[model samples]
Target: MKRRQLVRGALAAGLTTPALAALSGTRQSFAQALTRPVQAEVSELEAAAERFSYGYQGQAPTEVLAELVEYFDEKIPPLLDRPQSVTARMRLCRTAGQMAGMAAIVLGDLGERTEARGWFDIAARAAAESGDQQLHAWTLARKAMVPLNYRSPREAARLAEESRQIAGTTPTAASTLAAAVAARAYALSGHTDKARDALTDADRFMERISGEQRADTWLGHCEQKHHVHLSHALTALGETRRARESQDRALALSAPTSSMTRTLLLIDAAMCVHRDGDTEQACRQAAAALTNVSAHYRTGLTHTRAMELHRAIPAEHQAEPAARALRQLLAV
Candidate 1:
């Protein structure tokens, strides 16, 4: 069937706009096409959904998550619970899992850990239902960031490890992302050997990203995002010089409107300076990053990174003017 025919059929079947599939940078594929065209519909449906999703890519996390969760609520129940053919079931599961994973990631960025965990649980179920090993691995890998970034990295290493094991040898965009996040978790946990292994794995996987993946979207990998994750991992491992290079690459590659990500990148850059014994300069840099960021895009992840930067300052330097400035700024 043509894309138009599929969209019309979906509407005839009581589904909403094609944009429903487009949200979450939604990438989907079925093991096969059902009588209902499940496999044949993923890429086209996702394209429409992107048109709907593209306008808000630069918005604040809160705004973006609201729209996605709203669409998910409207669309998921029938897709997931209603009776459907085998191929349709697999296709819907893949779609739901991708959307859920993206929601969970945004929720994590906002520091809504409990909510994010709930979404990841649903994504996990969807992945299982779809029997998509890569989706399942990606969901687990994305879940790791909730603890590592918003709470404690120590709590996240295991999830990352599981993702790596599942991603062993596959070079899908999702698997590459899992590997990158796994490297961060390992680095933060002080596991130098594991961190090295995961980082190498991420690099290896990155080289094999295929045309089937949507590297431009949040649902997939891009060279810029790869570097951003690298900066975080390298900083965690105290490889400051290497971290700086990655940070620079990420910044250069960043979209001008991507304020939230760019802001977080700036904070990561500040941490690189901290690793160099320039505690005072790092504090000033972080405070400056926070200062320039609009309140709209200064998400929980943003504050979390800045706070971690503050706490890492040596006690003796805590009384320094820049340190106090950062503390007072965050307190508000």
Candidate 2:
């Protein structure tokens, strides 16, 4: 199916949040008058492309994401800078911002830090121009993940706080996003209690977020997936026991579907087990995980997790075939 058809399907399927409700009524009216059926096809294609691009994240090859990013980068600028109709410009800008946010995430996942930062800045600018505070906040929160990954937890915390402040009273998705980012920041900064508190706040916010709550086009993933992302952040902070517990909860909430995501999680689980001094099990899981990594594109997140598992194995244990295999995988 075409990209636009896919986005329409996603919207029809209720996969998207209602955060754009405030803008939708006015934009819809304007869109109806200014845009022809032919233009609608283009819009739908743009939205669908973004949706598929985001759906494959953490699971697809880097080249796939790179291709999507290039497509958006080529397609959106002209639409935003020179819309065929004034009435449709706002809607186009909003959609462009959402696509930009997806690109940022893809770039970050692929370890293209410089390009990711640029894309995130573009997304923020597009959100501002479209007057969508929710999109702005979501993009900012997503951008904060870069710092968190780089071990700059303080910077990540500041960005998360900024996002929360800007989000104001419409705190459903934005607040949840901010809380998740803040939780990771606190954990990385060695504020365990604060981290736990932030995570609790995130969970509470998530509970209150019903299907009818506001939504951003760019933040279209399932709410349950946030817990899995948060669990990984906890693992990064060295809270092995908590990370394991959270991972179990996340897995119970949603089964792994993507090879890359499953491999990454398995590696994480191995790290937790290794940290807990279960060398035998860690080696087994790590070896199993390594077998899958070759199937997908390499990502910094996965590489780092694999490195952790590699370092966790004791020298004596390294002599085992499984452990030796993991070491060889990391070396490559």
Candidate 3:
């Protein structure tokens, strides 16, 4: 339940905000269109996308997403104008959107904001074309994170609310995700009341989710991630006590191999502890969290949060080995 699952499933790559983005490439003409990809081809694409979805959470190399971006860009153009089953075309479009979204995240982490926004725009369009409200909603929700990361919480809240409206009363993971991100955005904007209400809505929506829905899409599989976002919103709203409690719950509920998420939650918890006046304890906790995580596992968002935690510490304590070590870890 790290940042990534807020839009798709699982934690988004390391310390960065877990929002989805899209890509832009030179427009391809429909003159080379094929009827549709064969079932085997579709299956292969699905398998690859799913594999990349899970791989994004751990130490999966950025190259993995890069390759997916290239693959989808080359493959999607030929299928755009082809006469095929509605189901098949939708599947293709959805896969392409997912790839574009993943690519956007990778590009953002690599410090390419303009390219990332282009990819995010493309993903949103593809999702809309697929007529998948869940996909469209989640993609927009991910785009909201860009504004939040850029310090435009008001805009982020607006976009998140828009995504929530698009998600409607679906009671699916996507709707829950939209609500959760809205909560975070509201908290960041200092609208504590709105944030709390959004959090309540998110919790209620998650309660209604029954069987698997949209399991084949990146926006699915986020049952436990709800708490992760809730924790972040709580933190931003100055509810340190509740924020720590929520982070503990998230860590306890998360899978063991989810080292990235564990690192994120630990960092959040450490901040809460620091807010409570246990400066040394907070420093120690943060240092320990960084120690356990591999360098390859850190995300831009996670690093952002870690830096915030470091700055929160007193200047005198900043020189302490624990604090210094945490800073060094993040610098890498």
Alpha-carbon local distance difference test for all models: 0.79, 0.70, 0.74
Q: By the lDDT metric, which is better: model 1 or model 3? A: 1
lDDT of 2: 0.70
- Candidate 1 clashes: the total is 2
Question: What's the distance in Å from true for residue 175, model 3?
Answer: 1.2
For model 2, the superposed segments whose C-alpha errors exceed 4 Å read: 1-42, 57-59, 83-87, 212-218, 236-242, 252-256, 311-324
Question: How well is each residue in 64-108 modelled by candidate 3, as lDDT tens digits?
Answer: 666777788676786565667778878888877777777776665
Model 3 shows how many backbone clashes?
Answer: 16
Model 1 agreement with the true structure over 1-332: per-residue lDDT tens digits = 45556655555756455545532122343322124443444544455445443434667777788878887787667445544678777877777788888888888888889999999999989898989888888888889889989657766888877876776677887788887887898898788888889899889888878774636676667888899899999998999889989989999998888777778888888888888888889888888888887886565889998998998888999999999999998888
Once fitted onto the true fold, the runs of candidate 1 whose alpha carbons sit more than 4 angstroms away are: 1-56
Candidate 2 lands at a TM-score of 0.76
Q: After superposition, how far is residue 8 of candidate 3 from its true place, in Å?
A: 52
> Can you give the TM-score per candidate against the true fold?
0.83, 0.76, 0.79
Q: Best candidate, TM-score-wise?
A: 1
Estimate the lDDT of model 1.
Answer: 0.79
Best by lDDT: 1
